[model samples]
Target: MKLYHSVDTRSLRCVWLLEELGVSYDLDVVPFPPRVKAPEFLAVNPLGTLPYLVDGDTKMSESVAILEYLLNRYDGGELRLTPDEADYGSWLNWMHFGEASLANIQATILRYTLFLPKPQRLPVVGEDLSVFLQERLKVLDAGLQGKTYLCGERFTAADISVGYALLLSSLFGYQKYFTPAITVYFDRLQSRAAYQAARAKS
Candidate 1:
């Protein structure tokens, strides 16, 4: 197995899961915005996106989908909640919520605030998205009011999926608005050995 990743990108989700599963895989760290910085990578994945995975004949791009693929293909039973489990629906919902909801807004804020040139940067747009992101985060904060993890006590890939979004919130300077519950939850996630190991590799 091999993964193409870039520092602080969504690929961290996959790397963290690989560490948690204790799987052997090669990490190929490429420059960020590989589409422009690493033109050669376009041949490997036309999309030139980060978090690209190659496992034998299988290849994946979406970060959350990669997590599911890794869990299903690698017998990651310890960190997976099956369909028969009571919290299965919640688990799947939170996993996709991280990227589809939180990261989507965060990425737009990033684009308006930093990625775009100074003349193109729009503080008003970034501010509006930041407010929108906080609204989304409030839902997560409420859900985490009494749980150690997203699916109650079990530390599954759901945590890893959402955890990366929390990490991104902090990296993008929106953590100052993090609610108390979110702060505590993110602290717990950061303290995990697997998360720490993945950070080191990133």
Candidate 2:
């Protein structure tokens, strides 16, 4: 598999997953600013997003989907996904919430703060985002109250995905605004081996 990636982006999720899975493959790092719009890239994903993967001719986009695909298909090989099964109903639930709800909240903040030009950006956007993120983070904190990983006591690719999401909040300077338990959760995710590897590459 070949991964097309950019630093400090959603690509970190795949990088962490790759490290956790101990997969050997190729990586094409595209630096930021003008970003990657190579014709070859568009051929893999018409949307032209980073974290695009090409496993032989099987091209895939979207970080969450790719992580799940790699884990399920490759058995997460070594740092394998726990409670491994053909049926991943419970695992998918946590992943869906993190991808759909948590990512949406963070992406919104990114757009308003990072993507939008300062002159046109709304300064008050943080207040609105805080309401949703604070509530949502508490839910995640409650879910992890007695657990080490998202699905249970063991780490899985879901943690790689959601853990990267939490790291994103920290990178964006949003982690500190959350509750204490949430802050500690973000810290642990930051300190993981796979996460550190992804950060170095990113």
Candidate 3:
């Protein structure tokens, strides 16, 4: 298995999962802004996105999908919950919650606050996204009030998925709005050895 990745991107979540699973794989580091600068990488992933992966014939792009794929294929049922598990539905919800919902808002925040030129930047838009993200985070915060991890008593890939987005949000200055629960959750995630290993790579 080989992973095409960029630092400080969602690909780090996959790398973290790989580390936690103890899987051996090659890392193909690509410079940021590859879509315009790296034609060879575009050939591998027409979307030119981070977390493009090729595992003997199974090619994938989306970071969350790649994560699920890795867990399904490599893990011995530790990082995920099966359909029989009581927390299965909640697990799936939070897994997609990070990427599909929070990430979209984060992208908008990045576009207005960082990517756009000062003349074109919209602080109001960024503020609105911050509000949106904070509102969404409330759900997670409430859910985590009594639980050690997102799904249940044990840590799972659901934590990896949601944790990655939460980590990025904090780095992007979203922590000011974080509830105490979220702050504690983020700290616990940061304390993980696998997360540290992935951070070193990032």
Candidate 4:
């Protein structure tokens, strides 16, 4: 298996999970916004999206989907919650929630605040996004109030999925709005050996 990734992007989620699963895979670190910085990558994936994975004949792009694929395909079932598990629904919800809800807001904020040129940057839009993000974070903070992981005591793929959004919050300077529960949860995630390894390698 091989993964095309960009440091600090959603691709880190896949790298983190791969480390936790102790799987042997190739990591191709590419420049961010690959369509511009690495035009050659466009031939491989027309979308030029990061977190692209190629495993034999299988290919994937979405970060959360790639995590599920890795778990199911690489004999990493230990980190997966089956359909019969009580927390399965919650697990799926939180996993997709991280990217669909949190990261989507973060990306928009980035576009308005940093990605665009100074003259194009919109302070009002960035501020509104920050407020919106804080409101969304409330759900995550509440969900983590009494649990070590999103689903429960076990460290599952859901944590990796959500943890990447938390990681993005910190990197993008929105962590100031992180609630107490979120702060503790992010700290726990950062302390993991696999998380550390993924960070160093990225």
Q: What TM-scores do the predictions have? A: 0.96, 0.85, 0.94, 0.95
Better of 2 and 3 by TM-score: 3
Give the Cα-based TM-score of candidate 2 against the true structure: 0.85
Query: Which candidate comes out best when scored by TM-score?
Result: 1
Give me the runs in candidate 2 sitting further than 4 Å from their true place.
Answer: 33-44, 77-88
Question: What's the residue-level lDDT of 103 in candidate 4?
Answer: 92
Ten contiguous residues minimizing lDDT sum, candidate 1 = 78-87
State how far residue 161 of model 4 sits from its true place (Å): 0.9
- Provide the lDDT at 110 for model 3: 96
Instruction: Give the lDDT of residue 159 in candidate 1.
Output: 92
- Spell out the clash pairs found in candidate 4: none
lDDT of 2 at 73: 75
In angstroms, the error of model 4 at 116 is 1.3
Q: In candidate 4, what are the lDDT values of residues 73-138, reduced to their tens digit?
A: 887676888899888898889989999889989999999989998999998998998888988899
Which ranges of candidate 1 are over 4 A from the true structure?
A: none
Top lDDT: which candidate number? 1
Per-residue CA lDDT of candidate 2, range 1-202, in tens? 8998888778888888888778897988876532344556666567777778889878887888888788877787533445556436666767767777687788887788778888877757866886888788888888788776775667766677677667777778877756776676667777888788888984
Collision pairs in model 3: none
- Per-residue alpha-carbon lDDT of model 1 for 1-202, expressed as tens digits? 9999998799999999999999999999999899889999999999999899999999999999999999999998968888998888988999899999898789989999899999999999988888889889989998898899998888999899989999998996889879999999999999999999999985
User: How good is model 1 by TM-score?
Assistant: 0.96
Candidate 2 residue 119 C-alpha distance from true site, Å: 4.2
- Among all windows of ten consecutive residues in candidate 2, which has the lowest summed lDDT? 78-87
Query: C-alpha displacement of 41 in model 3, angstroms?
Result: 1.7
